[model samples]
Target: MTAQAYCPDPWTPTAGENARTSALVDRFVELEAQVARARAEQATLLVSLAEIAVEQGRRSGSESEYDFATRSIAAELGAAARIPEGTIRGRMADAVTLVTGFPATFAALQEGRISEPHTRVIVAAGERLDDDSRVEFEGIVVSRAEGVTVGQLRSFARAVAEKIDPVPLTVRQAEAMALRGAWVSPLEHGMAEHRMIGPAATIYAIHDRLTQAATKLKATARAAGEPDPRTLDHIRADVLADLTLTGTPTAGDGLDAIHATIQVTIPVDTITGIGDDAAFLTGYGPIDPDTARRLAGNAATWVRVWQHRDTGALLTVDSYTPTAAQRRFLTARDEHCRFPGCRQPARRCDTDHTIPHSHDGPTTVTNLAHLCQAHHRLKHHSPWRMRQGPDGEIEWTSPTGRTYAHKPTPMVRFDAEAEVLMPDLHLSDEPPPF
Candidate 1:
């Protein structure tokens, strides 16, 4: 056998691994086709699931009962499919749109003529309208979706959405104002992404200022005969960071009052050296407990919120009153707009009465929820229905009769003894926990 030392057939370059650009392009084309087919199959499955959900709702008498059943089933579906719960909800929404509202788009998807992303663009473009308008809109756009690239299709879709929007211009302007805010999301390598959405004029003004400052910094470096080490983009980023952190254009040069309020919610045990669980950063998600400690220690004001131990649900804070306290509690509780998939932060949103005050709905926490101005108006004007569950969960029923549930993110609960002793323990005394 050793003497025979047999060799297998000489290996060939797999699809795109070789140096040929044409081979790589061909391989990509094939892959895209495969992906389209897979997406089509997934859509088919989702359509079936949507039909089942509708049927189940019809069978169930109460909306609450239907919601409970559907959510439980959704959890099961998410688990079996190995998808996140949020993703499953999004898929369900898309399925409803494809199967019911945009049958032509659905057919295109089934034939693998368009991918899921194209379908999403189509669906989102027509989302503000009822099924009839969507059908008409899809008829106009579906063919273009098949022909044009995704980016081009998106531009077309935006035009369509703008043309078909039923909201009056004055009302739309108000909604736009309410939607203006900033948010942060964690990124790879301990970096983060910060996004601010505002009026075009306001954003443009800010951008112009940043650009001017960046140019000046670069020019200053050149005049000093020092290397302009930073790119325009890098300089702009640094300038923005310096402006935000130090309340001045440059760090450590001239100090201005820090007027921004940053809220950090952390577990007591984490700061007490008992545990290392992540802490909550308002307008952001989890951060290192050490970072939380630093923020709290440096902050001029800190509010302690006691949460439930087992479920990590927030209980109450002692500092608030019946009126002001309720508002603060609602802000902490909701954290964001109660509408499904809407991430507009609670502080920026209007506290809406689930049942209108005119209808004798009390101004109690049970009757109130945070809704961005757009969604707030949408809820009031459209066929969309909202109700608060006994447990303070918000359930939204779409015009198509689909029900969605939104729950607040749970807070980490600390012990009563820890809460009592927290005021005595100074956050700055310990070394950096990192």
Candidate 2:
């Protein structure tokens, strides 16, 4: 009897195969950079065309004619590019800003150092900065754009621009607050995206409170070991519907007993009226210190957190209940989900053991982190691995052997003397009295 040898396809790549794949990836990235440069060239040309059109319109007649010329130029370009004229006009305005107001950022794009999104973020963040400040802002942001993701760059650009802006955030925020309103934009599948533009703190507080009530509903379901089909997001949406339509949340049990809570980190000096440093709002970037003070004064409980003078790493907090203290520390440490670029607020996340408790992972502050339910499952069910350093930097490794290090956003503190003060909040928590 003769038997044929079995030969199966290779599941793992050889060294040479891996090298080829790496080279291909590098080439793909290079091509993307080239596309970005081409986009910059196109934007420059569009700006030139718009300028010429406006000049011609000015020579011919009135302001209405000039605007019409701009619109006509957009329509012409839109027809060529197969984009809507309205979109083309918006692009034209952005192009003008990029070419004229942000020359260095434009050059960075032209040289293929950054992409279109990066440029947009830089421009928008620096928009409130004056000419000299904008130039400085562009130079700093463009220099840092190469090594970071677009999201990271956006946060950095915004913080930097805020620090350097000539206008006080309080003044700008006041002006913006006047324009606050709510609107709805229709979407497909009988859906819509409800939008609101208002004070950042108030908006964040509203969301935080909603998330808290939703989380309570989820916890109640889990405690009963009942199979609830609705996810946290679904529950949040339903709760919002109940509150707005019926004036009370009727979606879950014991929601009336749940209290809405929000976390705000403010500097000691700022709270004491000594400094105007912006406070770090959880899940959002920065808010004016005055707002932070007001929020702190209105809270029902206060947690005093200490930090090193040189490094702003969290040192300690006055502890009460061990479980509650741990949750507070983790929430303060991980402002959002530990997953890279996931800004899901900590209040909506599960406190997960970096190393599973069943696997002898101790129930300690260093051993725990906050992860959204989706990512918590992903960590367990998938090939992704996480490791936390002593400094609270989390390093996540994928199945492909690539690692991503996510550092905790440094807490804004002057020294170990600061306290986040929360007095009794008289507002009702049931329907979110925002």
Candidate 3:
């Protein structure tokens, strides 16, 4: 029976294996199509809900009521789905635009030929165009979306939209200039992010200047045989800080005197060198104990905060004054806006009375919470209601009767430590150089 020995090519797939692979590929494609269809259906439903809300509000006989109705519906849906109301509101707006403004693109998504991202890009690109021009823009971009990646489609759609726009470029540029501004956000590992939005040319020029400065500094270090551990990115960031902090601005008014302010909450044991608990950077999250010590060392005054041993809620500060200490306590307890998913820094927020003072609410810590201006107005105008719970938790009840609880951020913990390598810069009893 050893007459014939069978051999199979290792590189080749058997018929059975080939059939299984084909089936797998087919299943993957089918799943992708299913997802696209699901997204399309969701968009349609959101649009329908918005329309219903608007119609219901129309009976109330005011535009303000109509707006409130839309927001109320969004908040209800957001609470039920565990999503941020602001995010859901934005999505509802996008859904309306997608279905009404760009029907062809929506149809493409419905047919499983394009994705949600593709529809978004197309809608955003053609948003400023007239109805006729938008239709023309969609006719071209929808076909391109099916073939190209989302990024490519975005670029193409932008170029096409610009060409088709009825408004002059100069007019758009002037309007866009009003929106130019800078903002900061906290990042992971005890770092903060700065973003500036301006004219494309001006932003690029500023970046180019930073790059040139960084390049020169690196070359000088290399020439001097200095072991410069910093990368170009690091040097560029440092140069940006240095120029902004030390270099005089062209208008040079009181800007130089305006120093950045941040509140840091350090544990007593951490400061006494008996513990390594992470310090909370107030608006930001946790920073290492060593950096906290350095910041504390440079401070002219320190307010010691007392916390409950069982719960980490802020009890009071060391101040004897009632109002000032209460303000400090509230700021420390509510690190940011108490509204669910709102992170507007507490320093910039208004201390809102959970129960109106007119209704006999006392001016105490439990009756007060920090809310950004927008959310504060939303609380008063919309059907949303909130009540403070134990340990600084805020329970928000949406119009549809769903509740969401947002707990106060902890001030002291050993976890969430971000290891940041300190740059070699001169530190003194003054505002931070960068």
Candidate number with greatest TM-score: 2
lDDT of 1 at 433: 21
Residue 159 C-alpha lDDT in model 2: 76
Residue 70, model 2: Cα distance from true site in angstroms: 1.7
Q: What is the Å distance of residue 330 in model 1 from its true position? A: 52
Which numbered prediction scores highest in lDDT against the true structure?
2
List of clashing residue pairs for candidate 1: none
Residue-level lDDT tens digits of model 3 in 1-434: 11111121224445676577667767886888788889999999999989988997899999999999999999999999999999998999899988888899889889999888888888877898989998898887788777656754554576567657777554665677799999999999999999999755345446656665665666666777984789979977886787798793232323334333456677777676777655555433344566677767766666665544654444432222225545666666665688876766576567776765545545556667888777776676656677886556778765445566776653333222221111111111111211
TM-score of 1: 0.46
lDDT of 1 at 145: 77
Off by over 4 Å in 1: 1-19, 183-194, 204-233, 243-434
lDDT of 3: 0.66
lDDT of 1 by residue, 162-248 (tens): 445565333555666799899999999999999999754345335545665766677667777985888989977887888788768
Error of 3 at 101 (Å): 0.7
Tens-digit lDDT string for candidate 2 (143-214): 877755687667667777877887888887778778899999999999999888888778766676677787
lDDT of each: 0.61, 0.72, 0.66
Worst 10 residues of 3 by lDDT: 421-430
Ranking of models by lDDT: 2, 3, 1
**RMSD (Cα, Å) of candidate 2?**
9.0
